[model samples]
Target: MNSPDDTHESTVCPGCRAVLPSSRWPETPKYNASPECAEVAGELLGFEVENAARLGYLHQLRIDAYGGQHVSPDAPRIGPVFALNGLYMFLERGSGNLDVRTAHGIMANSYDDWPRLVPPDRVGELTAYDVLIAGGVDEVESALLKWARQVWESWPDDIRETIRELTVELVPERYFRR
Candidate 1:
């Protein structure tokens, strides 16, 4: 068995698969090569995959999303994307645009477009962006759909319009540079 002081090299960070290792725990065989990966693991976000196929998918997605070609591949890190009952939701920001990853695919929206309202049957399809529109992105509601649909739908059309008009995309400055 490898001793606690032994260091092993992993081709990729096991957590976020950020393509490099940052540091390994002192007494563990596991290695973390990227800060983002370390955070995901440190936070106990849980294993994303246990097989090479899924690992490949994760790596490809990271490359496809952010190019992963800068001084740090997948640098700056994506904000937390939450999942409930296996239904995952995340917001992707680009140059002057934002997209929400749904069960279907990534749907792009203008920096200022309103939700257009999900179907009644799809009320559960609340992305964090919906909460961001109704209140603040930093504010996360556990009853996510209730806040997005119940409170938001009850508001007047004018209020929704005002929100859409006033809201701005929260893309980080590094995104523009990429």
Candidate 2:
């Protein structure tokens, strides 16, 4: 049996609490995330941007989902809203063809004010690490979708409903399928 002090040292990310390996990548100043989590996010972003054609809208989905899951005290409230809107559009409305950026623009312009949301104590068990470990474009995409769904479902029902209503009110019917 190993001594208490001899236990493996895994870095626990402040945002997601995912046990990450020793940090090889530098922490990003953009998000209020731990070094390890930010590094993993950076890697994922690099992969998505590098394979933009293959990932398409998923690139934006990953960004929003990650942002939603890792909201900090000082972080802007709109980040999670954007994440849920993206989730509603792609997962709920089946509007994969509708660009996430366009949807965000619509939301931004339609609503001058947004409600302040409280981040849950725990976001989701799946982290960016899970998607990165999938190791291929197809596998990564699958993992990413699963991650997004998990994050979306993790939010409270009321919050989700608010996003649904916002999407319906802000996004015109022409954007959705008949």
Candidate 3:
């Protein structure tokens, strides 16, 4: 962990209780050891798990999704864009780390499990914006699935078919033509 003086110390991971003495960077999630724990970390932070498994691949996919050319000095980065109750999300880490924005921003990203405790329907006061801001191809697929589900049984046949075609574009080679 980092202190105001730029000194570091061993800190316990909130998700797995691991001592992150050698973490590459301070504020990096403790669940780096396993995909499942990574998911839990996001869950504990009131964020949805997007592209948890095979994160390295997810990182590449995010870069490809954003149209990349030159890679940064740092290797891979995990900028999982997690939605808060099927709504707004922290889009990306961008350069380094994120800030605690409008109390909602900090509250939404905090380690406290407050959002999960509140029923999604009861929180009508919170404005919901429908933007995927997918961080990777898999995340994009998941978003499409979610959108389809919301419009299912009522949406036009052509729109549903269009979404299906888009999803097909990202299917891995091994899963293609099935």
Q: Pick the candidate with the highest lDDT.
A: 2
The lDDT for every candidate, in the order shown, is 0.27, 0.77, 0.27
Question: Model 1, 133: alpha-carbon shift in Å?
Answer: 29
What does candidate 1's lDDT look like per residue over 1-178, in tens digits?
1235545544343322333323443322222134434443332212223333333223222222221111122322221111110111121222211222221122123232323321122222332223323432223233232432333343355634443332223322343312
TM-score of every candidate relative to the true structure: 0.18, 0.84, 0.18
Query: Model 3, residue 83: displacement in angstroms?
Result: 12
Tell me the deviation in Å of residue 116 in model 3: 34
Residue 88 shift from truth in candidate 3, angstroms: 21
State the local distance difference test value for candidate 3: 0.27
**List of clashing residue pairs for candidate 2:** none
lDDT of 2 by residue, 70-146 (tens): 87667677777887788777777766645567878888987867777776877777889898888899999999999
TM match of model 3 to true structure: 0.18
Which candidate leads the pack in TM-score?
2
User: What stretches of model 2 exceed 4 Å from their correct place?
Assistant: 1-9, 24-30
Q: How far off is model 1, as Cα RMSD?
A: 16.4
